[model samples]
Target: MLTRKQHELVCFINDRLAQTGVSPSFEEMKEALDLKSKSGVHRLISALEERQFIRRLPNRARALEVLRMPERPEKKAPSKVVSPQLRQLPAPANDVIEIPLHGRIAAGVPIEAFEGVSTLAVPAALLGQGDHYALEVAGDSMVEAGILDGDYALVKRQEVARDGEIVVALIDDAEATLKYFRREGAMVRLDPANRAYDPQRYLPAQVRIQGKLSGILRRYH
Candidate 1:
């Protein structure tokens, strides 16, 4: 998947090529993307090339060919953020609720997150008003965020996610992963908490926001 900058650059290049039958110059691309220097544009070009989204014509200074166009996601207005202070807290609960456990989910890379179905009993306080589920974290990519392997991730069901929110993202309706949801420009970026893992990018349509992280459960023993 391409980041927002990458997506914008690719689209810009595609439009320019289609209009003039020639690739845009570095200066034009830089201006189009609002980058201070052409270096940023170069990096975006390299990234696009690596992802096979765009390619440079051999021996051509500014010739870039679009390999494929990214699919646009459905249009929807982002939900308004409710201030934490404004939200009324639920009354204290002494009971526990059983939530569906969808097996293991990768924190380091995309994996088949929904597999065997089971149930996990969680404190009612751990979840709020929405439909909730649980997934066992299976990797260390989110260690920096205090999510470690073997921890239980409490998720609230939702189709849309705001930028910078941690969400369970299903990729291509096959694989799912736990990462921070962010909008780079025109693409979606999934950021891992650990410095060792690189952020993942994809077309907006390729990512389905399955849920938002509600709470984390850990066993000391």
Candidate 2:
């Protein structure tokens, strides 16, 4: 059996090859896997080749091909037990929901914002029903939250959010940013997950809650 990292590396390379008809560059693989250097990528590639999952073309650059893909495991029956909290939540419908993928949102300093670059189709079960949208994260301020540069944040559109919930906070009606939201009387505090960033506080009137975070998606390639 492939190790977890090896499995991920093979899947990523396979995805890129299938989508773009070419292997991803060393730099691309390095970034996708969060590897420190291209050497790490090389090792993974060697392992994949030894396992007969992939092959490299001779005398060619970016010439990798997938020989076989791992078979997906069979789906098991649903469990009978459901938590009380989960039972209160509605089950998602059996249909794909298309959500608008808004342009990048700043995770560090607030930035000028735009919306509706494209739409992404996701299963409704993944995100609870609401006016949901997505934003491509652009900064590393939320790295400690497992959110990284280039990650996509799935958000549920709402004007209000509970304290400690990660939110898209628009400051002074001019800039949009993402952070954990906290309320202190009439003031609002936006806290970044990274210790490197100090929390930002502002008046409630100056900040608008655009959305509350629902989930995150990271594409390796």
Give me the candidate number with maximum lDDT.
1
Q: Write the per-residue lDDT of candidate 2 for residues 50-71, one digit (tens) a residue.
A: 5578899999998998888765
Model 1 stretches with alpha carbons more than 4 Å out: 1-92
Q: How well is each residue in 8-66 modelled by candidate 1, as lDDT tens digits?
A: 78889889989999999999999998999998787778657755789999997787899
The regions of model 2 sitting more than 4 angstroms off are: 1-95
Report how far residue 49 has shifted in candidate 2, in Å.
43
Local accuracy by lDDT, each model: 0.79, 0.75
Error of 2 at 107 (Å): 1.0
